[model samples]
Target chain A: MYLEIKDLTVLYDRAMVLNGVSLTVGKGEFVSLVGPNGAGKTTLLRAIAGLVKWEKDTLKGTRAGRITLEGSVKFDGEEVTNLPAHEIVRRGLILCPERGRPFREMTVLDNLRAGAFGCKDKKVVKENLERVYHLFPRLKERENQISGTLSGGERFMLTIGRAMMSQPKLFMIDEPSVGLAPKVKEDLFARVKEIYEQGSTILMTEQDVSFAFDLAGRNYVISKGHLVGEGTAEDLLADESLRKTYLGL
Target chain B: MVEAILINGLVLGGMYAILAVGFALVFGVAKILNMAHTAFYMVGAFLILIMTIMLGFPSLPSIVLAIAIMGITGSVIYKLFLDRVKEHPVAVMIISVGVAILFQEVLLIGFGGHFRGIDPFVRGFVEIAGIRATYQQVIAIATSLVALVAIRLLLSKTRVGNAIRAVAEDREIANVMGIDVSRMCVITMGISAVLATVAGAVVAPIFMVHPLMWMHPLTIVLAAVVLGGLGSIKGSILGAFILGFAETAVVFLVPMGAFLRGAVGLSVMVVVLLLRPEGLFGVVFEEERL
Candidate 1:
């Protein structure tokens, strides 16, 4: 397994957000986690990417909500459940958070440059930036424009492009196609497909079933914080009861 | 007489702006009201005094050493004190006020609560608009201007500066993007301390240094920053100039304006806030701004 999770659980001050979820993504595999709202899908991805751990450390004694994370996350044969977010990014596991959260007041170019912060090789950074520009021409078009001013589709494109600059081995993206126009979503998915085809492992959580089925080779049906079903897209679609009960298909 | 006043007003405004810029920056990037900044300024002046008078150091080196000391003190304070109460504004304010008083008390104990002055970096001045401003005033104005321009360039052109701005916009998002946000906070605190110290070093000859002097100047600079809208360097400069010009006009134009110094500053702040609630160039404080 390229990425492995064993008994991962998260609790936010007595409210259980995740419950001992175990899953795996093989090297160079495209896996989609599909679930409805309140399914703990975002929390799982965040936990895997070390955000939950960061929150647990930062909000320990504050009036802010407490987060309790328990899990063993092994990425590339190394224990990574307790690493900080930036250290995880340094290790080539990147998370593109939901809803296109860029540094809003910054210019698009600056945001993209910030993504390459961990990379020291200037030549590699330049090449990655050029590739990001090529992947999302819209981001290149609005390179100098402030991120807050970008449209919905443009903002998503910028964020995804920003993540690409980090050169991730396992790209965990949460709801990339949400709130985008159908045509723009199609364009974005094509870019994602291009990335997958180029050999980086991808784990994405999406609400859109058909979109996930079309792109992901294997799928996990998670609902209310537990992995209810796991199989290939064809197997899940073939089972009528499983589709109706869990996937809402 | 008007020319002389105007010249003095601009210089005074420039010095005020320099003093407040770091305060604005710390708030802008960190969202912590560093009320202890004025204490750092006073300490800087005293450092210069001890160096030049007691240790027999040159005037320029004393100022430089003071700035360096304050810069280190800033990072240490952030790590030790401000870091604990960063998320709570009221708590931060209280702690900062406590720190300021502590600094004042320590300085008083050591120096015996007497006002003292440092030798001016320069001794003479050239004619400006046919007004005979002393080198002390000219040096204050020139140092502030040079520092401002250099800082502006540093922020706009450097990678580290860009990282600082990104963190200022949204600290969490900046961290997620692989920028070290805690390191940026330390750097910002250090820079703000240096600014306060440098301002003290340059302006100390004219204003003199006393343990309690920090309280009044802090109040004035806070007013200037608030009027300039918090967290904006340009706003700080504009607001300081506006305050300086208003104070100058009062002293020369009104019959008993010298006595109305405190009232004049208060009214100037009130007028600016009444005219534009966001200050001259500052953004509105949105809930999501943090």
Candidate 2:
């Protein structure tokens, strides 16, 4: 497995957000997690990115409930659980968090430059910038514009473009279609699908099940922080009973 | 005439501008109102006093030494105390007040509360619109203007400056951008320390250095930051002059000058704050609600 999350239990303050949740993703595979409101899909992604506060929680000390990434999360690997959010980005595991939270006052180009801050090689940075511009020409045009002035849909594109500047191995996006219009959401989904086809593994969470199923190869349904149902896209789309019961399809 | 008052006010106000800018930079970027920032100025004054008076060091070298010492001290404070206070803002404020008190006491114990003065950093005076200005004052004014310009350049041109602004605007987003947030914060504190020290050393000869000298600067710096708007460098400069000139004018014009100085300064800030709570610069800090 390229990435393996084995029985990961996450708690926010005193509330349990993920209870012994386990999942896996292969190299270059696009996986989408579909769930109802307050289902802990976002929490799971945040925990993986090391943004979730862990100091106040109590752990059960179960070996099965462990997050192990193959590349450097080996026994000798850096214990990223205690490291800050920036270190995770430096490791090429970038996350475009929910809410399209770009640096509001900074120009679009500055925001993109910030993404490449982890890379020391100037050549790599230049190449990355060029590639990001190629991927999203809109960003290239609006490079000097302040991020705060962008529309919701344009901000979404800039957010994805900013993440692309980091040159990550896997892209973890949360709720891309959250506040977008229907047609814009459709267009965004198409862009995300195109990104996946261009050779990057994706781990995304969404409340929009119909659109999520269209883009995702495999789907998992979560409820109140637990994985209740999971299957291939065809299996999930065909099964009416699973959708209504777990996902409210 | 008001011309003399305005020129003198601007000159002195520019120096205070430096002092308040240091305070604003740390507060804006880290959201920690370090009460001991004034103490760093005091330390700089004393360092220069000791170097030039006791050790017989030259003025320029003494200023450089004072800035370095203060910068190191500020970094140490950040590492030893301020880092722990980053989460609990109230605790940080309390601890900073405690640190300020500690610094004042240390100075009192060592220096025995005696007022000390050194010769001006530069010699001679020039008549500007019939107001005789000393070469030291001219040097102070020029140095301050140059420093402020340099700071503006650093903030707009350098990578570190952008990182600082990013952290100032939103720390979590800066973290996502792979900025070492803690490191940047420490740098900010250190730079503030250097700024405070330089301001102290430059003005120490003009205003006699005593154990209690920081009390006045501390009051004025805070008032300037609040009046200018929290987290704004430009606001600090504007506020510093407004307060500096207002106080000087009242003092020059009034009969009981010394007694009414504090009253005038406080009233100006109160009036400005009442009109604009976000500050004259229109900078607003989002208050986190529990």
Candidate 3:
């Protein structure tokens, strides 16, 4: 497993959010975690990002979980969980969270610079920025404009572009399709798929199960906090009972 | 009659601008009112006084040393206390007030209960457009303008400056981008402390340095920030100057005397709040709580 979770449990101020959730993602693989509203999907992703408050709550199971990135987390792969969120990004495990917009006050170019924050090498940052601009030429055109003024579709693109600035080995996006029009959603997903094909591993939690499964090679049906089922996207798509019960087809 | 009042008003307005700008910087970026800031200004006065009177340092060197010491003190406070309190807004507020009290006691213990002053850096008056303004007051105005410009450059031009702005806008998003929010917060506090220190140093020659000077300045600083919109640099400066001129003009024209000048500031603040609660120039001033 390129990325592994063992007995990971999470809570939000006493209410149990995730209970002994375990999963794995292979190198360069696209994985989708599909679930309903309030089904602990985001909680699991937040837990992996270490933004979840762990010690404040109770845990009955072995909360011992490990995330091993082929090397150390960064190019020199050392364990990065103990580090702060910024350090985790420096190690290339980046999360583009749901509904979180770009820093509205900053210009688009400045927002892009903020994304490449942990990279000590200016060259890498410049190269990554150029590549991002190439992928989303609209951002390049609107580089001077303040992020707050950007359209909804543009804001989503900037968020993804900002995450890409970190040059992550694994990229996780939560509900990228949320709040976007159908055409905008299609454009955003196409960009995300292109990013995935460029050798970065992806783990995404999405409400549109059909679209998510279509993009991801493997689908994990998450319910309440457990990984209920996992299989190839085609097998899971073909299963009628699983689709109706877990996916609300 | 009106000329003296106008000149005095301008001086006070400039002073208020200096004090409130520091408050707004910390509040805007770090989201901490830093109750200790007024105390830091008081400490700046004392530092300048001690350097000039006891240590025999030159005026420029004394001011520089005061700013440096206060910057270090502010950084230490951030690392030791404010960093831990960042997530706890209410706790930080209470703790900041406690810290301010602690600073007061420390000053009282060291300096005793008496007023003092640093020797004025310049002597005599300048006739500007046939208006007689003391050289010290002119220096204060010029120095403040220079400092404000420098602060603007630091906030808008530099990389760290941009990062600080980014953190202030949205801490979580900045963190996701890999910006060290703690470091930015610490730097903001440090800059605020330095500004407070400079304000003290600039005004020390004209105003007496005493243990209780902070009490008077704290009111003005709070009023300026609140009226200007809490956390806006421009708002703080504008509010400070407005209160400054209004109070000074009232004192000069009414002859209710110098002692009542403090009440002028308080009243102006109250009036601004009554008229525009969002402050003189703030957006999201009230809704920020939500």
The TM-score of candidate 2 is 0.90
Range of the 10 consecutive residues with the lowest summed lDDT in candidate 2 chain A: A67-76
Which residue pairs collide, candidate 2? none
Q: Give per-residue CA lDDT, model 3, range A80-160, as digits (tens).
A: 534666666766778898874688878998888888778768888899999999999999999999988888899989989
Off by over 4 Å in 3: A54-79, B1-3, B86-90, B285-290
lDDT of 1 by residue, B1-290 (tens): 69867876877687678778888888988889999988888888889989998999988877888899999999899889887668778988999999999999999999987878777777877786677788888788888889899888877667778788888887766766777777888899999899888888877888778999787667678889978888887888888888888777887888897788668777777777788878878775343321
Please tell me which model should have the higher TM-score, number 1 or number 3: 1
Best by TM-score: 1
Weakest ten-residue segment in model 1 chain B by summed lDDT = B281-290
Residue pairs of candidate 1 with colliding backbone atoms: none
Alpha carbon deviation, residue A34, candidate 3 (Å) = 1.4
lDDT string for model 2 (A1-249, tens) is: 666676777755456778888887778888999998899898788777765532221111323223332211211134455566778777767788887788777898878777777776879889988987887788889989998888888898888988887888878899999988999998889899989999999988998988888888887888898887788878876778876776666
Select the stronger candidate by lDDT from 1 and 2: 1
- Tens digits of per-residue lDDT for model 3 on B150-221? 988987767788788888888766777778777888888889889888888778888888888888778888
Find the candidate with the highest DockQ and give its number: 1
Instruction: Rank by DockQ, highest first.
Output: 1, 3, 2
**Per-prediction backbone clash count:** 0, 0, 3
CA-lDDT, candidates in order: 0.85, 0.79, 0.79
Docking class of 3: acceptable
